[model samples]
Target: MGDTANNTENAPKKSFFKGVKSEFNKIIWPDKQTLAKQSAAVVAISVALGVVIAIVDIGVVYGIEQILKIG
Candidate 1:
């Protein structure tokens, strides 16, 4: 009776870990070429977004300075 209770307590955690491992094994990860292409796209998009944000910031600063008449 005591052993049965212990088994119930531990079995769920063990099964969960086993299921995770099985899922990881079954995953078909992207190939190197695909990964590289995706990474490059991400970097390009990030750079483009940064440039846009920078332009907006510069415009705002210039406008604020002009309004205040302060360099």
Candidate 2:
């Protein structure tokens, strides 16, 4: 009865690390060509988003300035 309790107590910690090790071994890293392609995609998307935000910012600022001028 005591051994059963002890086993149940330690079961989770042992299984957790074993599962982690199993998952880590399954990883297949990208090759150089794939890495470069993905990197470029990320950079391109980031720059596109920045440009969009800048345009929106400029529009907002211009609108506020025109409103203030009219008042």
Candidate 3:
């Protein structure tokens, strides 16, 4: 009875790792050229977004300063 319980517990762990390995083998990884293009696109978008945020911040600060001066 004890041996049967131990085998049942270990059976799931062994099958789970086997399933993980099978899934990894099925993956189609991206090529280096595709990876580089995607990385560059992400970086360019990040920089463009940063510049837009900075411009908006400058405009807000200037507007607030003008309002304070009017008071």
Give Cα-based local distance difference scores for all models.
0.94, 0.96, 0.95
Candidate number achieving the greatest lDDT relative to the actual structure = 2
* Comparison by TM-score, 1 against 3, better one: 3
* Colliding pairs, model 3: none
lDDT of candidate 3 over 21-65, digit per residue (tens): 999999999999999999999999999999999999999999999
Return the candidate ranking by lDDT, descending. 2, 3, 1
Encode model 1's per-residue lDDT on 11-57: one tens digit a residue.
Answer: 66777899999999999999999999999999999999999999999
lDDT of 2 by residue, 1-71 (tens): 79999887877687789999999999999999999999999999999999999999999999999999999
What's each prediction's TM-score? 0.76, 0.78, 0.79
Candidate 2 colliding pairs: none
| Model 1, residue 49: C-alpha shift (Å) | 0.8
Off by over 4 Å in 3: 1-11
Displacement of residue 23 (Cα, Å) in model 1 is 1.3
